[model samples]
Target: MKQLISYAVAALSLVATQAAAAPVTYYIQSEPYETVSNFTACPLGGCTVKYAKSNRISGSITLVAPLGSNLTDEDIDLQIHSFSISDGQNTYTDAQFFVDVFAQSARVSTDSAGNLTSFEFKFDKTHGTPYGEASYADSKAKVSYIWISSAPSPGAAVAASNSTCQFRGDNVNGNTNGAGCMMAYDTDSQGASSASTTGVTMSLTPPPAPTPVPTLSEWAMILLGVLLTGAAALNLHRRRQTA
Candidate 1:
């Protein structure tokens, strides 16, 4: 009788698993048609303009329990990956950006001579809504990028070290801020000669909500199973006594 009850429990467990649904998956990407700005450290007591003119910003996001498997703003954890940002000449990887943004840190990408190429100071996810109506909702997350001149800049050399403003410098930090030289960067996003294309997209649908516990019918069936097994045991005992 005990063995019968155990078997019934195992059978119910299987049913519960089969009834449970899998969270769907969705692929997301975006295009930030905006220009970002950054300011270099005033080593010489002056600030230089640095900007990341977004050439193309795209990535994919996996959302759980999303409607229409749509990746909308929800109280769910987001697993975003495969992101890339480019400014025609230089490119920034997702690892160098999102990891720091989610971790509440800072990331800088540069070439040789410690010159800033593209850097993200603030991570903002409120920019564009890339989705369709009644299809799936999406969070229009956008981060601005600034474009800067290459390493060994002439302005840094001319301004930092010259008769106008005599200043000393050395390569203490890596390619981040142009070796303590104030550098001016340019990012033009609002103009006729700007990048025009479709917005960043988060397609391939998304995941659904997780399954809840078993229903009332399932519990009733469990009770029925116990009762039937107990009854069978009683009948078997009676037969044995008659024999």
Candidate 2:
């Protein structure tokens, strides 16, 4: 009985030791999308969202994952920290744009088996203008922006002649939740805005599962102990029967 208990403890110890550590992988899935499928608001509560309801608009989202693909706080910070957006005219850049940029959003992707494989990140307005000394703002104001068809309303927008920067803020009336704004700079667009660059998509994926190996030294030791304990128990039982 004592031998059986000892072997059991040994086996548990081996598993615990092996389970202590795991390697994490990092990689960028794709360029950040201008708009996700059902997302039209800033999911990460505090980020400022600009609501634009323009019929025709055009812009480009340039997202860079400075770190690998961990998406940790540092990764997120770096992602936002190294971001730049342009409509061939106005541009924005701010390091503190990561303000309140959190994860827990409904923007996620799934595998063919219907499993949650990865999730889309959230963004907030980083700055208002080029010389804006202030960097970030709190998540307090739940301002409901209204986008109308024919007219432009009171909202933070970077407008241009043949081009329009409507993607800077989220269209709350449209129920969109993506506002990753950092710094701001405006340029003159020579051509009109197109629908082509409006839907840039990007996602962060998780590392694959670790594979099993038959020659694992630690696992081998655990197996050996179990085999020996069973043999000893059997041998003791035989001796008692003979006695």
Candidate 3:
């Protein structure tokens, strides 16, 4: 009877250990940049030209958990987001705009299991000017320089044109997480007082299961069962000797 009890206790201990070994899961979200604008200008016929600035550039980022992906605060990272410039009527240089994460009130949240659950960013409309320049010349006339301004006065403007979010960690192969963990500006030019937005999605794939650790209770129960079995065998041996 003692031996049977010992075996039953051992089985119960094993079951408890397995019950505590369930896998962990995580989810995360990212902020959206849906408001952006700037201005540009060009020269025509050796005369100064002016252009009206239009604000119509913005975007968002979404991260998805890959088949075997796991995310931790220490392993996640991001880079400055920027945008390029183009005049529907002229040419311009691609400029790098820095995102003000703090000003935009950007934040990332996670679940109790340490999984990223949500992310968001709020953009503020600050006043500012957009400017560009181009040279002009009449047929066979001496080349002259021309400058154009998008706004009458320069003011505070949204800092970033392109943006990127980088998730670095083990098992993250390049381009394997759907969109490769990086997102940038999707427009060609900066304008004034308008909203243009784009979005990218990424996933966090968890790696293989980790090695299990036996809990203290499990160890105690195992030890008790072994001791009980030994004691029972010793009693049985004594009874046989007497018989």
Candidate 4:
């Protein structure tokens, strides 16, 4: 009996330990578009400037992973992978205006099973800046790209604009025809760590376990009764043989 009780205690301890180390889940959300300004050199000599305009192009992306996984919040970098802009009619591509935004570490909470009960991604946009210039034309430029673990080096011709001329930049400078505007990439890239951002913390609580129909105590009592009966029978047979 003493041995059986010790084994049960050991088993329960193991179960508790496994429960505390379960897997966790996390979610990601991104907002890509923000306002930016473009400058142009005057047709004759002086520098021409177009005040930054508000580009309403924005989108979101979500990713999931276990709690304390190999992936870090810093790995959640967002680059203007690709994009295109439109002026209510025609659309153009802005391939060179790629930028990298760094994401802040995530705030994570887990349950007994080590599963991620909740998570939030916070990012800083100040790290991002324009990479290359576009041609001076009057068409909407659209660009697209990916958000990955690290920043990528500049590449060859990203995409083409509607310009009849093969201009390297996305034709951002309005030509004599007054057609210079950029459809830049907008996204959120955040890093993760053990700390929390915004000075505000978030928490996740696991749902309560369902009640058992008969209860554990009742089952335990029934098992004890069966064991006692078997023990009594064995003792009676031993006494009869001795007599």
Ranking by TM-score: 1, 2, 4, 3
Residue-level lDDT tens digits of model 1 in 1-243: 999999999999998765443343433223333543333222222122232344343323332322323222212223233343333423445465323222111233434442334322212111222311111111111222322211232211000111010111212222221112122112122110123233333345432333567789999998999999999999999999999
Query: TM-scores, in order shown?
Result: 0.25, 0.23, 0.21, 0.22
lDDT tens per residue, model 4, 98-125: 2222232223344666444443332221
Task: Tell me the lDDT of model 1 at 72.
Answer: 23
RMSD of each: 26.3, 23.7, 27.5, 24.8
Q: Summarize candidate 3's per-residue lDDT along 143-242 as a digit string, tens digits.
A: 1110111122221112232221222111122212222212222122321122223332212442233357789999999999999999999999999999
lDDT of each: 0.31, 0.31, 0.30, 0.30
194 Cα displacement, candidate 3 (Å): 14
The total number of steric clashes, by the backbone 3 Å criterion, in model 2 comes to 23
User: Tens digits of per-residue lDDT for model 2 on 169-221?
Assistant: 43222222344222221211212222111222222353243355657887889
Q: Single out the weakest 10-residue window by summed lDDT for candidate 3.
A: 141-150
The list of candidate 1 runs beyond 4 A from truth reads: 1-24, 29-56, 64-99, 102-200, 205-243
Candidate 4: TM-score?
0.22
Q: Find the candidate with the highest TM-score and give its number.
A: 1
Determine which window of 10 residues in candidate 4 has minimal summed lDDT. 188-197
